[model samples]
Target: METKRLNKAISETGYCSRREADRLIEAGKVKVNGTVVGLGVQVSPDDKIELEGKLISKEVENIYIAFNKPVGIICTTDTSIKNNIIDYIGHPERIFPIGRLDKPSDGLIFLTNDGDIVNKVLRSGNNHEKEYIVSVDRKITKTFIREMSSGVPVLGTVTKKCEVERIADHTFKIILTQGLNRQIRRMCSYMGYEVTRLQRVRIMNINLDDLKVGEYRYFTPSETEEINRLVANSGKTMDASFD
Candidate 1:
Protein backbone atom coordinates (compact mmCIF):
# COMPACT_ATOMS: atom_id res chain seq x y z
CA MET A 1 0.00 0.00 0.00
CA GLU A 2 1.16 3.49 -0.78
CA THR A 3 1.84 5.83 2.16
CA LYS A 4 2.11 9.57 2.85
CA ARG A 5 3.23 11.91 5.59
CA LEU A 6 0.75 12.11 8.46
CA ASN A 7 0.28 15.85 8.28
CA LYS A 8 -0.41 15.82 4.56
CA ALA A 9 -2.90 13.03 5.09
CA ILE A 10 -4.72 15.04 7.69
CA SER A 11 -4.79 18.13 5.46
CA GLU A 12 -6.09 16.11 2.53
CA THR A 13 -9.10 15.22 4.66
CA GLY A 14 -9.89 18.95 4.73
CA TYR A 15 -9.82 18.81 8.51
CA CYS A 16 -6.92 21.32 8.90
CA SER A 17 -3.62 22.50 7.46
CA ARG A 18 -0.40 20.58 7.70
CA ARG A 19 0.82 22.92 10.41
CA GLU A 20 -2.25 22.30 12.54
CA ALA A 21 -1.90 18.62 11.84
CA ASP A 22 1.67 18.70 13.09
CA ARG A 23 0.57 20.52 16.22
CA LEU A 24 -2.13 17.97 16.91
CA ILE A 25 0.19 15.11 16.19
CA GLU A 26 2.76 16.48 18.58
CA ALA A 27 0.11 17.13 21.18
CA GLY A 28 -0.73 13.40 21.25
CA LYS A 29 -4.20 14.10 19.88
CA VAL A 30 -3.85 12.38 16.56
CA LYS A 31 -3.76 8.58 16.25
CA VAL A 32 -3.12 6.21 13.41
CA ASN A 33 -4.92 2.89 13.64
CA GLY A 34 -5.19 3.20 17.41
CA THR A 35 -1.58 4.28 17.90
CA VAL A 36 -0.71 7.86 18.88
CA VAL A 37 1.86 9.06 16.38
CA GLY A 38 4.46 11.82 16.30
CA LEU A 39 5.24 14.30 13.58
CA GLY A 40 6.69 12.88 10.31
CA VAL A 41 5.01 9.51 10.75
CA GLN A 42 3.79 8.00 7.49
CA VAL A 43 0.57 6.12 7.02
CA SER A 44 -1.24 4.33 4.27
CA PRO A 45 -4.46 5.64 2.73
CA ASP A 46 -6.32 2.84 4.46
CA ASP A 47 -4.85 3.75 7.81
CA LYS A 48 -7.52 5.04 10.08
CA ILE A 49 -6.57 8.54 11.18
CA GLU A 50 -8.50 9.62 14.21
CA LEU A 51 -8.37 13.03 15.82
CA GLU A 52 -9.67 13.26 19.34
CA GLY A 53 -11.55 9.99 18.77
CA LYS A 54 -13.31 11.26 15.64
CA LEU A 55 -12.57 9.56 12.33
CA ILE A 56 -11.22 11.91 9.64
CA SER A 57 -11.11 10.74 6.07
CA LYS A 58 -11.62 11.60 2.44
CA GLU A 59 -15.41 11.44 2.73
CA VAL A 60 -15.59 14.69 4.65
CA GLU A 61 -16.35 17.27 1.98
CA ASN A 62 -15.28 20.82 2.69
CA ILE A 63 -18.07 23.34 3.21
CA TYR A 64 -17.93 27.13 2.73
CA ILE A 65 -20.69 29.54 3.74
CA ALA A 66 -21.25 33.26 4.11
CA PHE A 67 -23.52 33.87 7.06
CA ASN A 68 -25.30 37.13 7.93
CA LYS A 69 -25.19 36.71 11.67
CA PRO A 70 -27.72 38.36 13.94
CA VAL A 71 -26.73 39.90 17.21
CA GLY A 72 -26.79 37.59 20.27
CA ILE A 73 -25.38 34.56 18.45
CA ILE A 74 -21.92 33.87 19.80
CA CYS A 75 -19.18 32.51 17.56
CA THR A 76 -18.12 29.25 19.11
CA THR A 77 -17.95 25.56 18.32
CA ASP A 78 -18.84 24.40 21.82
CA THR A 79 -22.48 23.33 21.78
CA SER A 80 -22.76 23.84 25.54
CA ILE A 81 -22.70 27.58 24.93
CA LYS A 82 -26.24 28.90 24.60
CA ASN A 83 -27.18 30.36 21.20
CA ASN A 84 -23.82 29.53 19.64
CA ILE A 85 -23.26 30.09 15.91
CA ILE A 86 -22.97 26.36 15.22
CA ASP A 87 -26.42 25.60 16.62
CA TYR A 88 -27.74 28.77 15.03
CA ILE A 89 -26.88 27.54 11.54
CA GLY A 90 -27.63 23.88 12.30
CA HIS A 91 -25.72 22.79 9.23
CA PRO A 92 -25.21 19.13 8.45
CA GLU A 93 -21.47 19.55 8.22
CA ARG A 94 -19.46 20.20 11.38
CA ILE A 95 -18.18 23.61 10.40
CA PHE A 96 -16.91 26.52 12.50
CA PRO A 97 -16.76 30.30 12.15
CA ILE A 98 -13.62 31.71 10.53
CA GLY A 99 -13.43 34.61 12.97
CA ARG A 100 -15.81 36.24 15.37
CA LEU A 101 -18.24 39.10 15.81
CA ASP A 102 -19.08 40.45 19.25
CA LYS A 103 -22.21 39.01 20.84
CA PRO A 104 -23.91 42.38 20.45
CA SER A 105 -22.45 43.20 17.03
CA ASP A 106 -23.06 41.16 13.91
CA GLY A 107 -23.17 40.85 10.15
CA LEU A 108 -21.13 38.95 7.58
CA ILE A 109 -19.03 36.07 8.95
CA PHE A 110 -17.78 33.03 7.13
CA LEU A 111 -18.27 29.43 8.30
CA THR A 112 -16.44 26.52 6.80
CA ASN A 113 -15.30 22.96 7.32
CA ASP A 114 -12.24 23.69 5.23
CA GLY A 115 -9.85 24.14 8.12
CA ASP A 116 -6.89 24.59 5.80
CA ILE A 117 -8.10 28.04 4.77
CA VAL A 118 -8.99 29.39 8.20
CA ASN A 119 -5.56 30.81 9.03
CA LYS A 120 -5.01 32.00 5.47
CA VAL A 121 -7.98 34.38 5.80
CA LEU A 122 -7.53 35.40 9.43
CA ARG A 123 -3.82 36.14 9.99
CA SER A 124 -3.28 39.89 10.48
CA GLY A 125 -0.07 39.70 8.49
CA ASN A 126 -1.99 38.58 5.40
CA ASN A 127 -3.64 42.03 5.11
CA HIS A 128 -7.10 40.63 4.29
CA GLU A 129 -9.73 43.34 4.77
CA LYS A 130 -12.84 43.37 6.94
CA GLU A 131 -15.23 46.28 6.36
CA TYR A 132 -17.65 47.57 8.96
CA ILE A 133 -20.47 50.13 8.99
CA VAL A 134 -20.59 51.63 12.44
CA SER A 135 -22.99 54.02 14.16
CA VAL A 136 -21.65 55.87 17.13
CA ASP A 137 -23.57 57.47 19.97
CA ARG A 138 -22.26 60.90 18.97
CA LYS A 139 -21.61 62.59 15.66
CA ILE A 140 -18.47 61.35 13.98
CA THR A 141 -15.79 64.03 13.96
CA LYS A 142 -12.86 64.61 11.61
CA THR A 143 -10.44 63.99 14.42
CA PHE A 144 -12.14 60.71 15.21
CA ILE A 145 -11.68 59.62 11.62
CA ARG A 146 -8.07 60.76 11.58
CA GLU A 147 -7.13 59.05 14.83
CA MET A 148 -9.01 55.91 13.91
CA SER A 149 -7.34 55.74 10.51
CA SER A 150 -3.93 56.37 12.01
CA GLY A 151 -4.04 53.86 14.90
CA VAL A 152 -5.37 53.43 18.42
CA PRO A 153 -3.48 51.89 21.27
CA VAL A 154 -5.51 49.05 22.77
CA LEU A 155 -4.99 45.63 24.35
CA GLY A 156 -1.53 46.87 25.25
CA THR A 157 -0.62 47.30 21.56
CA VAL A 158 -1.40 49.88 18.93
CA THR A 159 -3.78 48.75 16.23
CA LYS A 160 -2.65 48.80 12.63
CA LYS A 161 -3.47 51.79 10.44
CA CYS A 162 -6.72 51.29 8.57
CA GLU A 163 -9.11 53.02 6.17
CA VAL A 164 -11.86 55.12 7.79
CA GLU A 165 -14.47 57.31 6.09
CA ARG A 166 -17.45 59.19 7.39
CA ILE A 167 -20.59 57.99 5.65
CA ALA A 168 -23.14 59.76 7.85
CA ASP A 169 -23.34 62.20 10.73
CA HIS A 170 -23.13 59.40 13.32
CA THR A 171 -22.02 56.64 11.04
CA PHE A 172 -18.87 55.82 9.09
CA LYS A 173 -17.12 53.05 7.20
CA ILE A 174 -13.91 51.46 8.35
CA ILE A 175 -11.78 48.72 6.83
CA LEU A 176 -9.20 46.80 8.79
CA THR A 177 -6.68 44.11 8.01
CA GLN A 178 -6.13 43.11 11.61
CA GLY A 179 -8.69 41.47 13.86
CA LEU A 180 -7.67 42.75 17.27
CA ASN A 181 -10.03 41.70 20.05
CA ARG A 182 -13.01 44.09 20.13
CA GLN A 183 -10.74 46.33 18.12
CA ILE A 184 -13.35 48.58 16.53
CA ARG A 185 -15.32 49.11 19.70
CA ARG A 186 -12.21 49.90 21.70
CA MET A 187 -10.87 52.24 19.04
CA CYS A 188 -14.13 54.20 18.98
CA SER A 189 -14.20 54.35 22.77
CA TYR A 190 -10.67 55.72 22.77
CA MET A 191 -11.89 58.46 20.47
CA GLY A 192 -14.60 59.28 23.05
CA TYR A 193 -17.33 57.61 21.02
CA GLU A 194 -19.57 54.66 21.82
CA VAL A 195 -20.61 52.30 19.06
CA THR A 196 -24.35 52.19 19.12
CA ARG A 197 -24.47 49.78 16.23
CA LEU A 198 -21.80 47.95 14.30
CA GLN A 199 -22.31 45.68 11.35
CA ARG A 200 -19.65 43.99 9.27
CA VAL A 201 -20.54 44.71 5.67
CA ARG A 202 -17.77 42.78 4.04
CA ILE A 203 -14.92 40.29 4.58
CA MET A 204 -12.37 40.15 1.85
CA ASN A 205 -14.33 40.03 -1.44
CA ILE A 206 -17.59 38.70 0.04
CA ASN A 207 -20.39 40.98 1.24
CA LEU A 208 -23.56 40.80 3.31
CA ASP A 209 -25.55 42.36 0.45
CA ASP A 210 -29.31 41.62 0.51
CA LEU A 211 -28.82 38.79 2.98
CA LYS A 212 -31.12 39.56 5.82
CA VAL A 213 -29.84 38.99 9.33
CA GLY A 214 -29.34 35.25 10.07
CA GLU A 215 -29.35 34.19 6.44
CA TYR A 216 -26.48 32.35 4.70
CA ARG A 217 -25.38 31.23 1.24
CA TYR A 218 -22.56 29.49 -0.57
CA PHE A 219 -19.87 31.40 -2.39
CA THR A 220 -20.16 31.83 -6.15
CA PRO A 221 -17.64 30.35 -8.58
CA SER A 222 -15.94 33.70 -9.16
CA GLU A 223 -15.80 34.45 -5.46
CA THR A 224 -14.17 31.10 -4.79
CA GLU A 225 -11.64 31.59 -7.56
CA GLU A 226 -10.75 35.14 -6.58
CA ILE A 227 -10.42 34.24 -2.91
CA ASN A 228 -8.13 31.35 -3.72
CA ARG A 229 -6.02 33.70 -5.81
CA LEU A 230 -5.91 36.32 -3.06
CA VAL A 231 -4.83 33.87 -0.40
CA ALA A 232 -2.52 31.93 -2.68
CA ASN A 233 0.53 33.45 -1.02
CA SER A 234 -0.94 33.98 2.45
CA GLY A 235 0.96 32.76 5.49
CA LYS A 236 -1.10 29.95 6.98
CA THR A 237 -0.44 30.78 10.59
CA MET A 238 -2.86 31.51 13.43
CA ASP A 239 -2.94 34.76 15.37
CA ALA A 240 -4.70 35.82 18.55
CA SER A 241 -6.96 38.17 16.58
CA PHE A 242 -10.65 37.80 15.77
CA ASP A 243 -9.45 38.64 12.24
Candidate 2:
Protein backbone atom coordinates (compact mmCIF):
# COMPACT_ATOMS: atom_id res chain seq x y z
CA MET A 1 0.00 0.00 0.00
CA GLU A 2 1.26 3.46 -0.84
CA THR A 3 2.23 5.49 2.18
CA LYS A 4 0.85 8.99 2.78
CA ARG A 5 2.25 11.82 4.81
CA LEU A 6 1.28 11.55 8.46
CA ASN A 7 -0.03 15.12 8.40
CA LYS A 8 -2.20 14.29 5.39
CA ALA A 9 -3.49 11.16 7.11
CA ILE A 10 -4.23 13.04 10.26
CA SER A 11 -6.00 15.82 8.36
CA GLU A 12 -8.05 13.29 6.34
CA THR A 13 -9.56 11.99 9.60
CA GLY A 14 -11.34 15.37 10.03
CA TYR A 15 -9.60 16.05 13.33
CA CYS A 16 -7.46 19.01 12.33
CA SER A 17 -6.05 20.73 9.31
CA ARG A 18 -2.81 19.51 7.72
CA ARG A 19 -1.07 22.59 9.06
CA GLU A 20 -2.36 21.93 12.57
CA ALA A 21 -1.29 18.27 12.39
CA ASP A 22 2.19 19.35 11.40
CA ARG A 23 2.31 21.65 14.40
CA LEU A 24 1.30 18.79 16.72
CA ILE A 25 3.88 16.47 15.19
CA GLU A 26 6.58 19.09 15.60
CA ALA A 27 5.55 19.59 19.19
CA GLY A 28 6.21 15.86 19.80
CA LYS A 29 2.53 15.07 20.33
CA VAL A 30 1.96 12.47 17.61
CA LYS A 31 3.03 8.80 17.43
CA VAL A 32 3.07 5.98 14.92
CA ASN A 33 2.94 2.37 16.08
CA GLY A 34 3.75 3.49 19.61
CA THR A 35 6.86 5.32 18.40
CA VAL A 36 7.12 9.06 18.15
CA VAL A 37 7.71 10.23 14.59
CA GLY A 38 8.96 13.60 13.51
CA LEU A 39 7.74 15.71 10.61
CA GLY A 40 7.56 14.25 7.06
CA VAL A 41 6.98 10.62 8.06
CA GLN A 42 4.59 8.70 5.79
CA VAL A 43 2.21 5.97 6.92
CA SER A 44 -0.08 3.76 4.94
CA PRO A 45 -3.57 2.48 5.76
CA ASP A 46 -2.07 -0.63 7.37
CA ASP A 47 -0.10 1.43 9.80
CA LYS A 48 -1.32 2.01 13.33
CA ILE A 49 -1.19 5.74 13.75
CA GLU A 50 -1.61 7.50 17.04
CA LEU A 51 -1.73 11.02 18.40
CA GLU A 52 -0.53 11.25 21.96
CA GLY A 53 -1.09 7.48 22.29
CA LYS A 54 -4.62 7.67 20.89
CA LEU A 55 -5.31 5.67 17.72
CA ILE A 56 -6.17 7.99 14.84
CA SER A 57 -8.09 6.77 11.81
CA LYS A 58 -6.41 7.81 8.55
CA GLU A 59 -9.48 7.85 6.37
CA VAL A 60 -11.65 10.80 5.46
CA GLU A 61 -14.94 10.54 7.35
CA ASN A 62 -16.70 13.87 7.25
CA ILE A 63 -18.14 14.98 10.57
CA TYR A 64 -20.62 17.86 10.93
CA ILE A 65 -21.91 19.25 14.23
CA ALA A 66 -24.23 22.10 15.07
CA PHE A 67 -23.55 23.99 18.29
CA ASN A 68 -25.66 26.62 19.96
CA LYS A 69 -22.88 28.82 21.20
CA PRO A 70 -23.76 30.89 24.24
CA VAL A 71 -22.46 34.29 25.23
CA GLY A 72 -19.06 34.58 26.99
CA ILE A 73 -17.72 31.33 25.52
CA ILE A 74 -14.83 31.85 23.18
CA CYS A 75 -14.76 29.73 20.01
CA THR A 76 -11.16 28.60 20.17
CA THR A 77 -9.01 25.55 20.86
CA ASP A 78 -6.89 27.17 23.54
CA THR A 79 -7.50 25.21 26.74
CA SER A 80 -5.43 27.41 29.04
CA ILE A 81 -8.47 29.64 29.57
CA LYS A 82 -11.77 28.32 30.88
CA ASN A 83 -15.09 28.58 28.94
CA ASN A 84 -13.69 27.41 25.64
CA ILE A 85 -16.02 25.53 23.28
CA ILE A 86 -13.34 22.98 22.36
CA ASP A 87 -13.04 21.61 25.92
CA TYR A 88 -16.74 22.14 26.52
CA ILE A 89 -17.95 19.87 23.71
CA GLY A 90 -15.45 17.16 24.75
CA HIS A 91 -16.01 15.00 21.69
CA PRO A 92 -13.69 12.01 21.40
CA GLU A 93 -12.88 13.09 17.88
CA ARG A 94 -11.03 16.36 17.55
CA ILE A 95 -13.05 19.00 15.73
CA PHE A 96 -12.77 22.69 14.97
CA PRO A 97 -15.36 25.36 14.27
CA ILE A 98 -16.15 25.85 10.59
CA GLY A 99 -16.49 29.59 11.28
CA ARG A 100 -16.33 31.84 14.27
CA LEU A 101 -18.98 33.32 16.53
CA ASP A 102 -17.92 36.38 18.48
CA LYS A 103 -17.83 35.89 22.24
CA PRO A 104 -20.77 38.19 22.78
CA SER A 105 -22.91 36.58 20.06
CA ASP A 106 -24.84 33.33 20.29
CA GLY A 107 -26.36 30.95 17.75
CA LEU A 108 -25.81 28.04 15.36
CA ILE A 109 -22.10 27.27 14.97
CA PHE A 110 -20.87 24.44 12.81
CA LEU A 111 -17.95 22.26 13.94
CA THR A 112 -16.00 19.84 11.84
CA ASN A 113 -12.64 18.21 11.47
CA ASP A 114 -12.88 18.15 7.72
CA GLY A 115 -10.17 20.61 6.64
CA ASP A 116 -11.21 20.76 2.99
CA ILE A 117 -14.76 21.65 3.88
CA VAL A 118 -13.53 24.22 6.36
CA ASN A 119 -11.51 25.94 3.67
CA LYS A 120 -14.32 25.67 1.16
CA VAL A 121 -16.96 27.11 3.48
CA LEU A 122 -14.78 29.92 4.73
CA ARG A 123 -13.63 31.15 1.35
CA SER A 124 -15.26 34.55 0.93
CA GLY A 125 -15.68 34.00 -2.78
CA ASN A 126 -18.07 31.12 -2.19
CA ASN A 127 -20.56 33.60 -0.73
CA HIS A 128 -22.28 31.25 1.74
CA GLU A 129 -25.27 32.97 3.30
CA LYS A 130 -25.39 33.58 7.05
CA GLU A 131 -28.70 34.72 8.48
CA TYR A 132 -28.91 36.65 11.71
CA ILE A 133 -31.65 38.02 13.93
CA VAL A 134 -30.55 41.29 15.40
CA SER A 135 -32.27 43.50 17.94
CA VAL A 136 -31.19 47.09 18.16
CA ASP A 137 -31.65 49.45 21.08
CA ARG A 138 -34.48 51.33 19.33
CA LYS A 139 -37.09 50.78 16.68
CA ILE A 140 -35.80 49.74 13.28
CA THR A 141 -36.61 52.24 10.57
CA LYS A 142 -37.25 51.73 6.86
CA THR A 143 -34.42 54.17 6.06
CA PHE A 144 -31.96 52.15 8.15
CA ILE A 145 -33.00 48.94 6.44
CA ARG A 146 -32.55 50.52 3.04
CA GLU A 147 -29.12 51.85 3.95
CA MET A 148 -28.05 48.45 5.27
CA SER A 149 -29.33 46.73 2.14
CA SER A 150 -27.84 49.34 -0.16
CA GLY A 151 -24.29 48.66 1.10
CA VAL A 152 -22.54 50.49 3.92
CA PRO A 153 -18.86 51.34 4.16
CA VAL A 154 -17.17 49.43 6.98
CA LEU A 155 -13.59 48.74 7.97
CA GLY A 156 -12.22 50.54 4.93
CA THR A 157 -14.46 48.60 2.51
CA VAL A 158 -18.13 48.48 1.62
CA THR A 159 -20.21 45.62 2.96
CA LYS A 160 -21.89 43.70 0.20
CA LYS A 161 -25.52 44.62 -0.39
CA CYS A 162 -27.53 42.44 1.99
CA GLU A 163 -31.10 41.29 2.47
CA VAL A 164 -32.53 43.31 5.34
CA GLU A 165 -36.05 43.31 6.78
CA ARG A 166 -37.55 44.82 9.91
CA ILE A 167 -39.23 42.12 11.96
CA ALA A 168 -40.45 44.34 14.83
CA ASP A 169 -39.98 47.74 16.37
CA HIS A 170 -36.56 46.80 17.67
CA THR A 171 -35.93 43.52 15.86
CA PHE A 172 -34.64 42.93 12.38
CA LYS A 173 -33.39 40.13 10.13
CA ILE A 174 -30.45 40.32 7.78
CA ILE A 175 -28.91 37.79 5.46
CA LEU A 176 -25.33 38.41 4.36
CA THR A 177 -22.76 36.57 2.34
CA GLN A 178 -19.72 38.41 3.65
CA GLY A 179 -18.84 37.68 7.26
CA LEU A 180 -16.51 40.33 8.57
CA ASN A 181 -15.28 40.35 12.12
CA ARG A 182 -18.14 41.50 14.36
CA GLN A 183 -19.83 42.47 11.14
CA ILE A 184 -23.40 43.01 12.29
CA ARG A 185 -22.34 44.92 15.34
CA ARG A 186 -19.93 47.08 13.43
CA MET A 187 -22.47 47.81 10.73
CA CYS A 188 -25.19 48.76 13.23
CA SER A 189 -22.80 50.90 15.21
CA TYR A 190 -21.87 52.70 12.03
CA MET A 191 -25.53 53.65 11.63
CA GLY A 192 -25.85 55.30 15.07
CA TYR A 193 -27.59 52.30 16.62
CA GLU A 194 -26.44 49.85 19.24
CA VAL A 195 -27.01 46.16 18.66
CA THR A 196 -28.59 44.96 21.88
CA ARG A 197 -28.53 41.36 20.74
CA LEU A 198 -27.16 39.43 17.78
CA GLN A 199 -27.89 35.81 17.07
CA ARG A 200 -27.04 33.80 14.02
CA VAL A 201 -30.10 31.83 13.00
CA ARG A 202 -28.90 30.02 9.90
CA ILE A 203 -25.83 29.07 7.92
CA MET A 204 -26.72 28.11 4.40
CA ASN A 205 -29.56 25.59 4.84
CA ILE A 206 -28.73 24.66 8.46
CA ASN A 207 -30.80 26.46 11.06
CA LEU A 208 -30.59 26.68 14.81
CA ASP A 209 -34.24 25.60 15.07
CA ASP A 210 -34.93 24.42 18.62
CA LEU A 211 -31.33 23.72 19.62
CA LYS A 212 -30.93 25.49 22.94
CA VAL A 213 -27.85 27.36 24.03
CA GLY A 214 -24.74 25.28 24.76
CA GLU A 215 -26.34 22.21 23.17
CA TYR A 216 -24.82 20.25 20.29
CA ARG A 217 -26.00 17.65 17.83
CA TYR A 218 -24.25 15.63 15.16
CA PHE A 219 -25.43 15.79 11.58
CA THR A 220 -27.05 12.75 10.04
CA PRO A 221 -25.10 10.81 7.39
CA SER A 222 -27.26 12.07 4.54
CA GLU A 223 -26.85 15.66 5.66
CA THR A 224 -23.11 15.30 5.87
CA GLU A 225 -22.97 13.73 2.41
CA GLU A 226 -25.04 16.49 0.86
CA ILE A 227 -22.90 19.19 2.44
CA ASN A 228 -19.69 17.53 1.34
CA ARG A 229 -20.89 17.46 -2.24
CA LEU A 230 -21.98 21.11 -2.09
CA VAL A 231 -18.69 22.37 -0.66
CA ALA A 232 -16.46 20.09 -2.69
CA ASN A 233 -16.26 22.70 -5.45
CA SER A 234 -16.55 26.00 -3.60
CA GLY A 235 -14.64 29.14 -4.48
CA LYS A 236 -13.08 30.59 -7.63
CA THR A 237 -12.17 27.72 -9.81
CA MET A 238 -11.06 28.17 -13.43
CA ASP A 239 -14.00 26.28 -14.86
CA ALA A 240 -16.66 28.40 -16.47
CA SER A 241 -18.86 27.53 -19.43
CA PHE A 242 -18.37 29.47 -22.63
CA ASP A 243 -20.98 32.21 -22.62
Best by lDDT: 1
TM-score, per-candidate, Cα-based: 0.90, 0.79
Cα error, residue 50 of model 1, in Å, equals 1.2
Query: Using TM-score as the measure, which candidate wins?
Result: 1
**Which residue pairs in candidate 2 have backbone atoms (N, alpha carbon, C) closer than 3 angstroms, thus clashing?**
14-113
- Residue lDDT tens for model 2, 1-243: 799888878877876766678889999999898889999998988888788778877354567899999988888878787889899888787788876888888898898877656656666667677899999997888899999998888878888898999999999999987877777888899899999888998887788999999999988777677776767778622111100
* Candidate 1 lDDT tens digits, 149-242: 9998998999999999999999999999999889999999888899999999999999899999999999988998888899999987768465
Query: Which ten-residue region of model 2 has the weakest summed lDDT?
Result: 234-243
